[model samples]
Target chain A: MTLKLKLHTKPEVPLEADCICPDRMQSLNMTEIGDLVTYHGNRQVPLKNFFECSGEFDGEIDIEGDLVNVKHIGSTMSFGKITVSGNVGVHIGAAMSGGEIIVEGDASDWVGPEMYGGRITIKGNAGHMVGSGYRGSTVGMQGGEIIVHGNVKNETGHVMRRGLIVVAGNSGDFTGVNMLAGTIIVLGEMGIRTGAGMRRGSIICQTKSELLPTFTRSCDYLPLFLRHYFKHLESLGLIISDSLINSPFERWCGDSIELNRGEILLYAGK
Target chain B: MKIKSTTIVDTFAEAFNMYVSRVIITADSKEWAIAAAQSITGFATSVIGCKCEAGIETIIDPNDSPDLRPGVSVLIFAMDAESLGKRLIERIGQCVMTCPTTACYNGLAGGSPVIVGGKLRYFGDGHQISKVIDGLKLWRIPVMDGEFLVDDRFNIQEAVGGGNLLILGKDQKVTLKAASAATKAMGKLTDIILPFPNGVVRSGSKVGSKYKKMIASTNDAYCPTLRGVVEKSELDDGINSVLEIVVDGLTLKAVENAMRVGLMAAIKPGIKKISAGNYGGGLGQHHIHLLKLGF
Candidate 1:
């Protein structure tokens, strides 16, 4: 069964709906689901005032219409799946523990922040701070995977302890900055200060990335272990070209200012 | 039963339970993979004297291997899981780890878990890194060529060991030939290993020895040289040599299938008779009766 939620009216102001996650909506009836509360601008309002819900129910929830003003679309969802056809608001899969979420349109900032488990795939552009920790938080994305097909803004995977973040398109500055431990693979160009202050983690750039001055050039060779990561990403339906799979990478061990062991791998070949 | 005028003796081959683990060693080429496999399984012929029995089961195609490299699947059998675990860790660490560009993986993933790289990671001292891909943890120990990737743990399960047959012939030339043919026929069997040298055991043993200090001694009953002096010599007038092919399999069906192939291959001319050893059902619990070969 599939649950369909269509926006009935475009909100004049931003609406913060924290009840759209699959875990919270899986057991609720259409009436109960509509009665879920959200803040329209500053005042609290029921979800029924903004969206119309229908369809045979299953673990899959489909959200339709432009949700650019909606927030917390799939926050804290641990089970089931959620698919959004149009643009979505901030914190798309914040703190998600399990299951999967697919966004067809662009997603706003803080997508999958501090997620524990599960996977989030965004087909369009993503705003700033995708898969980053909350401000001043020590850890971000303890587990799970976040894959973006389009360009993303800055501060992606900030302070991530574990998990994978894959950006297929260009990324803004400070990608994987202050990372404790995890893997971040960027297929496109990246802005400045990549892997800055990272304690322990890996940032792989398919194209040349703007490396921080703290990073020292190590060597230019193919790390055989990266094949495991490439094959894994291939299994997840990502296109891993033969050239990229066998390409040599320029290794840069960075964040010497913090005396950390993080590494930045830049693709040295086409 | 008679096949090509050779008689199948009316006896049974007794076997006992053992723990088995299959390890797949992959390398940059088939040569290195096989080189490591040979070293890892060396000196492992029989559990009686050698602590374990191990042999290469088959060659894996590069495309089929997890690392997409040429590989060899080897099986090791011991008295129990604990023994198998220790033997696997020691052998793989010393042999496969020393071999260039070789990575070891667990071939039998669904079997009960047994430690492999968990303890071997100490070789790195302090530089080992663990990567978990698709729920399988692999330990990467930095090496000269690159890194040595090995699964954290292998798997072990109950298996059958000591399934064997004796090939009796008029002379050593014919007896060894018949045993060689049988080994060749059963060598391709999956989940089974012929641990003896060239898959033929010349020194078949009995349970006890006349010397009090020894636990086992040569089977004098099947000794053609002792036919004149021994009171219970089982050899016939023309019989001069006897060889055995011991099988250790991960499953009973695998042992049975290998026996069927081996028995048929040993029935050519110059082969006088086919028999098997047993302690009269007092020892090993599983018995493969000769008459049930059904060939």
Candidate 2:
């Protein structure tokens, strides 16, 4: 069962989905007319004010049409699958532990911030802080996997302790600023100051670009461990093709000033 | 009752309780997923010799997998949770981490299996990174191959093991063939999964050994020569061969379904009556009544 919520032509005003019920998502059976939360104006409003609610109690929900003002599609949703057919606002799946979020279109900032588990896939592009630490803290994301198909802004994986963040398009400055742990793989060119203060993690930049002066080059040898990792990246639809997954990587271990356990590994063509 | 001209046994197939967990490994392609599974499940034939029994449960499509890649689900069973955890770490470290484009995940969502990934993360040597998406915690251990992704925790469940029905045939070939056919049919089951090499075992052991050092030994009652003098003999003349199939299931009802289908498949051409090896009713609480099932 699925709940289809269509937010058509809503301008300004952020329609936060903090009150949207996820437990009843799958129970909705989805066959009947489901509930939706659309907004108009520049003020804050509850979710129940917009769309009419109706449906069975199945564990699934879908958001159709344009949702430029809709924020937090599946915030803190533990179970159930959520699909968005069009573009969305900020905080797509903040703190989501279980369930899946599929966005056929692009998304705004913080795609999957602090998610413990679950998955979020964006077909188009994503904005800044896609999977970064909230407000003042580091330790950005603890768990979960985020796959962004388009370009992203800077500070992508700032202090993420765990989880996987894959960006298919180019990235902005500070690719993985102050990253404590986790993996951030950028398929396209990376902006300046990549992996600046990374302590214990990996940042794989597929494109050949300049790195922050702080990052130190360890060696040119291919890491034996990456053969298995690259292949996994392909399966997730996050990285290079499977046939060329096992290519050699240019290994650089830096952000040496910090915990120094982190590494920025780029695929070095053999 | 007869199936393919073979007599149906009047006895039930007995089973014992064991710990089970499912492991899902995903990689760049179906080939790498299968490769990792084969490596991890290799040399793990049984609890008696290998300390555990494991096999590939099913292949997952990209859409269904966590990473949307080619992946395979494997079921691993052992005598207890400790062993299960140890084997998982050992196998994933050596096999999955070595296989190109492979990432390991806990197939079991909730329950018991001691956390497999949270423990193995130390192997990352401080390079290990964890991710919490949707509530599931995953570990990313940076390996030379790139990175090995795995689920943080694996649910452990109590499962029935050693559920078997011996195939008594005129020759070894016929015995193996009949047993293979039965196992092949049962292997496709969802409730019970066969964790063995090709789903058949030639050596079926018994409880307690004649020697003082051994805890359990071979079944002498089924031995053709010992058939007469054996106190609880279940074999007769012309019964030259015997083979056992072990099934692991989440529920007793699941085991029963497997046995019903297995027994029916076992008794085929060149086969005799089917019988289960049990240490009496005292050993197990869940029992399958052969008569009730057949009727």
Candidate 3:
């Protein structure tokens, strides 16, 4: 009973297809769903213009084809699951409170921005601002989890107050800039100024990086609490080595410009 | 009924409703974990005097432990949830936290939550950090060795306690051997603990004493020395010695299961009879009948 959507015609501009969410399609028939309104770059159009919709919604939606021009696929969805078969556009799962969205390919910027709950997993590389707040917003991604398997651009979790963001590959500069409280774990290399201006939060890196001068080295020890997070990430299909789980981490208390409560744990190795 | 040469007395063990909390202590080595477990469970034999009854439930393998360290599980029982919670705080704070290379965690999944690590974090003098992972909150208190990680709260649940078995034998050595055998078998079971020394109690007691201040006194009926003086001695002439095993468990069924296992293992040639302690079924909430044990 999954609702299947395949792109029949590529859109000339980014299409706002927030109606593709499971919450909105659960009660709609094929014809009614096809008639759903979408905006193709400020032009109002029926969803059937560029995509062929089939099947009934049963709390799950399987969407296929390159969704690079499709934005807002599961916006504000409280429950249910959405699986994108290929590359997805920006604003996917934006502000979603519950449920899960899985992207098989790369994702655009602003993945799960300001999300309260739910999970958004990007199997490939992601654009900038992976789980960040929008411009002029006070908080971002209060809860939920965003896991990216590949590399990510700068400002991965900007101003994020809560929730978990795991980047399995390399990340650009300002990884958790202005973060208030949350956990951002970068398994690969990270760029400069990690956790800059963060009031309270945790940024963990597997590989060493040049930390900002605002952070002060505290001590080197094995934090048993990280074992739980490592086990959880391993369950989510991330490859965590046994040596990494047992390694000692150098604790750095940072963001002295703000609350000075944020911490960055750099692996000290066995 | 006779399993071998021993007779299963037609009596029941009176068990009362109590509160229990399971605490898992993990450490860098099994020795340290057992050290903490032994320290916390010390002086906790009976609620009558000790205010709680506790024992080591099992030694958990590193692979099965929460933090992948060598662990020992201990269960503590008190008269009520509030008292049990207080005992948990006192024992864990003084014993487990003081032990080197030890971290404690709540073993039970569902129960009324009692704050333990939340209170212990103050030992860090405002430097303690809290981390919430997968909805489970943990406190990281800075210590001289490194950091002491503990769960924020431990769960306490309603449990059963005071389950007992009286093993009568031809002599003291034979009785001790039989009781040891029974405890070894019962120790293999989960959700239950034999709280006495080496899982055998020599000085079994009655409800009250002739002294006004003493709420409990030695059970004179089964005392081999008083067999001739006492009018109604439970022990016969051949039964010169007796020992008791007290079981406390998270559930009545678990107590019954442990009792059944102990009863079967205690049936030896020197063991004359296997009896149970009860107050005519007037004090406790549950009565475990020996004859009706469908073993």
Candidate 4:
């Protein structure tokens, strides 16, 4: 069973819908869910006022219509799945500990911010700070996976302590910035200063790009470790071309100004 | 009972409970895969001196392999998980790890995990990387010919070993032919392996030796040359040679199935009698009663 929600009335002011997670809806009846209060700007209003909710769900929730003003849709949901069929507002899936969130359309800023477990798959573009730590916090995305099939804006995986972030399209500047540990794979063009303060973890760029001056060239050879990740990526339905699988890579080990254990691997062609 | 004019012996094959693990080794081609398998299974005929018993289980197609390469599955058996883990690490490290374009994987996935590549990954120095696919951890170690991908652990389970069928023939040539046919048939049975040299043992032994220093000695009772001097001989007057096929399998059913196949293959002309070896129920706990199998 899935709990279905449709926005009957679009709020002019952004709604802080942090309570929209499946964990909160699994126990409430339709009337009880209607009574659950959500903040619209500074005013508190019951969810039934703006959204029509139905379905007897067991561990899954589906939201329809444009949720561009809905914030924190699946935040802190430790279990179950939340699927958004349209564009979602800021803080979507923020601080989620478990379960999966799949977005079929574009997502706003702070997507999956500080998410620690489960997986989040965005089929469309994502705004800035996806999987990044909140300002003043040193850790981000301590665990879990974030896969964005489309372009991503700045500071993706910023201060990420652990987990994987894969961007299929171009990424804005400072991708994997301040990463303490984890892996970031950008299949397309990457912006400048990638892995700027990464102490450990790997950043793989398929496209030809220049690295930061702080990273020193380690070697030009085929790494055996990539096959393990490639096999995993393939299982996720990501196609890893023969050229990339058999290609020799130029390994640059750095963020030397930090722990010096982080590496940036760029394809150098076969 | 007579089958194909050969007499079926009324006896049982005593077998011991053992720990076994199966490993799948794949390579760029069948040749390389079988080479790695042969090397890993070599010198592992018995636990008496070799410390383990191992053999090639089957050849797998490239499409079925983890890396999409031609592969070979091998079964290795020891007395316990600790010994099995040690032998797997040592053999895979020296044989498969050194073989060209070879990758090792655990064939059994769901039992108690025994460490394999988890320990071998250190050979990569600092370049080794680990990835979890479908919740199974695999390690990639940087090698000269690309990378060596190995599963982190292999499942181990209790199994049966030393299940045997003895062929007594009119002559050495007849015994060899019968044993060859029996081995050929038993090879088709899954989850079992004939671990002896050529999958046939000529130097079968008894429980104890006449010498005080040796724990086991040759079975003089079945030796045609010692027929006259021995206290008792199990062989008939025309029987000049005896060949034994020992089966080690993942379960008692597997060993019994293999023994049935072997007996069917060996019960033919030129073979006078078919029997099994046992130390009067004193050796092993698990017994494969040849007559009770009704094959």
User: Between 1 and 4, whose lDDT is larger?
Assistant: 1
Q: Model 3: how far is B283 from its true place, Å?
A: 2.1
* Tens-digit lDDT string for candidate 2 (A1-270): 455565543645777665454743443343323333333355554344554444443666777768767777788888878878889889988888888888899899888888887888888989888778798875688778888888889889888888788888889998888888887888888998898888878888776778877677776644434444555666666556643354566777778788777888876774
Most accurate candidate by DockQ: 3
Among incorrect, acceptable, medium and high, the docking class of model 2 is incorrect
Better of 2 and 3 by DockQ: 3
Ranking by TM-score: 3, 1, 4, 2
The TM-score obtained by chain A of candidate 4 when compared with the true chain A:
0.96
* Candidate 1 error regions (>4 Å): none
User: Per-residue alpha-carbon lDDT of model 4 for A1-270, expressed as tens digits?
Assistant: 788888999999999988788878777888998888899999999998888988877888888989999999999989999999999999987888899999999988898899988888898999999899999999998778888888999999999887788888989999989888778888888999999999877888888777789999978876655665677778777888878877888888889899887888998994
Against the unseen true structure, what C-alpha lDDT does each candidate score? 0.89, 0.76, 0.93, 0.88
Which is the leading candidate under lDDT? Answer: 3
Off by over 4 Å in 4: A218-228, B124-127, B143-146, B292-294
lDDT-best of 1 and 2: 1
Model 3's C-alpha root-mean-square deviation from the true structure amounts to: 1.9
In model 4, pairs of residues that clash are none
Worst 10 residues of 3 chain A by lDDT: A20-29
Ranking 2 against 3 by TM-score, winner? 3
True contacts kept of each: 0.35, 0.20, 0.55, 0.35
Cα lDDT of model 2 overall? 0.76
